[model samples]
Structures are given as C-alpha cells and as structure tokens.
Target: MKLSFLIKSLAGAATMVAMAGPALAAAQSAPSPVTLKGDVMLEKIVTENGVSKTQLVEPKVVIPGDHLLFTTRYHNDGAQAVTNFVVTNPLPSAVALASESAPGTEVSIDGGKTWGQLGSLKVTGTDGASRSATAADVTHVRWTIPTIAPGASGEVQYHGIVR
Candidate 1:
C-alpha cells in the first residue's frame, strides 16, 4: 500500500509540472517593463456622410501634384505608458499632406518602414524599384505623443499629394 501511494504521488507531481510548463516559459522570456507601452490599438471611424470619418469619402486617388487629406486615430491599450514613442503610418502613393493639424507631427522622408523626429530617417533598401523605401520616398506621417497612457488615444491628420 505504501509503495503504491509513493508511485501515484510522483506521477501527480510530474503532471503538475507539465501543465505549468507554458506559464514558466513565458515568465522567463518576458521583457522588463519600460516607459514604452506594451499593446497598441488602431481603429478607423466610419461614417456614411460625417465629415470626420475614417473611411475616405472623396476619392483618395488623384493626379500627380494634387493633394488629399487623410486621418487616423490610435489608442494605447497596454499596461505601460508610451512617451516619446514614435507612431508611423503609410500613406497612399498618390497622397501627401496638404497642410496638417495643429500639433505638428513628423513626416518620414523615407517610406513608412522606419521613422524619426520632425525631420526624416535615412533608409537604405536593396529594392531598386522607384516605390522602394528610401529617404527620398516620403510617404508617411509620424508623431511622438507626450504620454499615451493605458486606455488613452491619439490621432493624426495629414495631406497626401498624388504622385
């Protein structure tokens, strides 16, 4: 009877460890908390006839040198607060900022891949295509918010000049 109890206890312990393996692995691999927020959220405001809708009403496509306005909002839903963290988005090839919003945001002269301050980030990509990511291929708007607290949100509106 004693031997049987010992065998059963060992088997139960092994089972418990197997069940907890994933939790242990995640704890070990987790990154340390920092000022940067953990999770980011994006949403588009759709309106059939509203002026401030996420969905583009007027045709986004335009002739070269023509400009169109675009808007997008982002929310922080993570446990951390984001400060001086850059937000980047790709604009349609045929768009560019006409003017901009009150609080000016950075525009990356390079494509939408990397971002920087109000200036631009230098890019060096192997793609030789004209639309490839490059410092000269400004197709994005970037901004560093003061602090995007968890559950807080921000927005960006800009112009797109059709190439």
Candidate 2:
C-alpha cells in the first residue's frame, strides 16, 4: 500500500504549541514563537561490503509489517525563550506503534483525550472489557519540552509498523 497518504495525514494532524500562561494566552492572535515540521520515513536494511546498516528513507510505499519512523522537528523563531512547549503527533489508523517510545515520551490510547505512560493507560474494547494499553494501542505520542531557547531547534521521533 502507498504510505504517502498516511504520512501526509500524520503531518497535518501533528501539533506543536507553547503552553503559555493566561497573559500569553491573551496574545493568541500574535504569531507563534515556535514552528514545527513533521515527516515519516521507511526503515530499510541495506548490505554493502558484507556489512548491513539500517537506513531511514523517504517512504514511497509500504507493506504490512514494514517499519516506519515518524518525526517532529521544532524550532524557536522568536527572540525570547519558549517554555512548556508540547509536541503531539497522532498516529494513522494504518500504523501500529512498535517497540518502546523515546524516554520521557507520553502516549495516549484514547484519541489524545488522555495521556500517560503506556503501562499506566487502559483501553476499553467493544466487548465492554478494559485491558492495559500496549504499544500497538497507542493513538498518539507526545513530548514535553520544558524550555526552548531562541534559535534552538530539536526533534522527537517514534517508531511504528504498517498494519
């Protein structure tokens, strides 16, 4: 299946905002101090000179079980520092989160309505039963950046597998 659609959907759904205080909230009409960019890549293993290396390449198409990497890059464009910056990315229904997320990353299994560590979250099935959420159950991934200095840029990433 072509994964470009999934990637595009994810990029559009990803959000980055500064968790400002009431005073700053009043200035919401003003330009944001932080800018965000999102991308998705397909993971591939290539062999050269009898050595194998994993590479992240732009995703064109993907098959079930293919590994994908999702990343969000943030930059502080304002003159002052930005505090309590949060970045959140919603996963596409075609993908299932794979392995452990980055350290300090919080996950949401309920469509971003609630957030917590994967181990601490729960999911309700159609059968009216609740089960501990797993990586595959993650609907969103987030990272809380305490501070981002002027002109500073950084990125956060997570892994997923095509469903």
Candidate 3:
C-alpha cells in the first residue's frame, strides 16, 4: 500500500486524550498542554558483510507480511505535572498486532468500549462459539502513565504486521 495512506491512517487512529489534574480544567479554547506525534516505520533485515541486523526505516511502500513498528511520542508542555495521562492508539485495518506487548499495556478487541490483556479477552465467532481473543483480534492499544513532569517527554510503541 502507499506509504502516504498508511501514515494518514496512523495519524487518524492515534489520538491523545484523557488528561487529569489542573490541565483538565483549563479552558477548552486553549491548546492542549500535551503534544503528541505519531510515526509508522517498516522493519527490515539488512545483511552487511557477514552479519545481519534489523533496522527500522521510513516506508515508501508496504506489502502483506511486512513487519511494522508504530510509535507515539508525548511531551508535557504545561507548567505543572500532569497525572493520569493516557495514550491510546487504534490499529489500522490492514495491520495485525503482534503477540506480545509491554507490561501494563491494555488492549481492546471490541472497539474502545472495554480493554484487558489479550489472553483475558474473548470474542464470539459467527458460528455461536466463543474463542479467546488473540493478537490478531486486537483493535486498540492503551497505556496509562502515572505522571508526566513538566517539560518531560516519553514514548510508547507496539509491533504489528501488514495484513
């Protein structure tokens, strides 16, 4: 698929919201104290000389079975620390989540209504049988940061494969 379309989809799916503390009470007209930037990278294996290494590079085109890395960087621009900050990202339709995720990360299979660990969630098939949800069924990923000090920055990342 075209890289631009993938980038656009990533941009639309990654949304920064759910702020707590004094920042929540700020005027709606004012800009958000937290700034977010999202990026999608293609994972490639390059062999130089006699050794092989994995690298992440900007994707100009992606095909099925290609591994990808999705990342979101966040920074607190507010004067005071922000607590209970949450970062949520939706998987693109053409991507399937990897089997493992960072500890404390939560995932949603039935849209954004509910979230839990991959193994803890279930999905009912069209045949009327319930089955355990797998990484392929993940639709969204979320991370709740306890606190972000003023001027502090951090990032969260996940892996996926093109469908």
Candidate 4:
C-alpha cells in the first residue's frame, strides 16, 4: 500500500503513535514511571557503483520486499523500579513480518487480542483447516520487560518486509 493511503486511513485514529522519546518522558510528570515510545525505520538494499549496501533512512517510499525494523524504546524514570513493563506495537498491513524477532516478544495474528510465538499460533485457513501461523501473518508485536530500574532505558525491535 502507498504511504499516503495509510496516512489517510489511520488519520482517523484517535490515538496516534506520536514519537515520544526519553526527553519527552522526563519533561512531563517530573520523571515518568514507565514511558514507552515507538519509531519506524526503513532499510533497503541499494546498488551504487556496483557495490550493494544496505541503508537505513526515514520512511518515505518503500517497495515490496524492502526490509524494515520497527522499534520501541522504553524508559523508567520513577524513583522506584517498574516490573512487568509491557510495550505493544501494531504492524501496518503494508508490511509482513519477515523474520523471528526479539527473544521475549510475542506476536499476534488476531489483531491485538491474543498473541504467542508465531509457530505456536494456529489460525484457520480459507478452507477451514487449522494451520501454523507464518511470519507474514503477524499483526502485532508485544514485549514484556521483566523489570526496569529507575532512569534505565532499553529498546526492542522486530523485522518486517514491505508487502
């Protein structure tokens, strides 16, 4: 799908995923207990002067099969540690998960309701037979951070392919 179409369709969403980094977290609430934010990055294989190189750039125009990595960075700024901090990021239909990602991350094929390892998820096929979920079938990715210490920060990432 074209980027313009996605912007037009998702613009109606009430909660937009604004890019909020650690600076934004610290400014408000005088140190957030747990602040999570997401960012999108585009990577493509470019051949220049007969040398192929992979480049990461701001998402603009992406073609089918282009690789991408979606990442969410979380920070803990409260006076105490936070346990079970979770971050959930939705995958745009424009991209298909192309690889197994973050070790502790869970994938959802049924939107965001239920999630598990891709191999462990079962979905009914068009013919009404259950089958193992494929990476391309992922709809969302979630991670459960065991614990985050005060003023600590970390990031989780997932791989995807433009489709």
**Which candidate tops TM-score?**
3
In the range 1-163, model 2's lDDT, one tens digit per residue, is 4699988777666632333455577878588889999889999989999999889998998899999998889999999999999888899999988865634569998899999988888788999899988888889998899999999999989999999
Q: Output the TM-score of candidate 1.
A: 0.41
Clashing pairs in 1: 94-162, 95-160, 95-161, 96-159, 96-160, 96-161, 97-159, 98-159
lDDT for each of the candidates? 0.57, 0.87, 0.87, 0.82
- By lDDT: ranked, best first: 3, 2, 4, 1
Q: RMSD of candidate 1 to the true fold? A: 10.5
lDDT of 1 at 62: 44
Off by over 4 Å in 2: 1-29, 48-52
Model 3 per-residue lDDT tens digits across residues 135-161: 899999999999999999999999898
Tell me the RMSD of model 2 versus the true structure. Answer: 14.4
Model 4: how far residue 112 lies from native, Å:
2.1
Deviation (Å) of 100 in candidate 3: 3.2
Estimate, for each residue in 5-78, the C-alpha lDDT of model 4 and write its tens digit.
88887875634444445557668757457777888789877899999998889889878987888888888878
Model 4 scores worst on lDDT over the 10 consecutive residues at 12-21
Off by over 4 Å in 4: 1-31, 46-53, 102-104
Give candidate 3 misplaced runs (Cα > 4 Å): 1-26, 48-51, 102-104
**Overall local distance difference test of candidate 3:** 0.87
**What local lDDT does model 1 show for residue 89?**
64
Q: Where does candidate 2 clash, by residue pair?
A: none
Model 2 accuracy (lDDT, Cα): 0.87
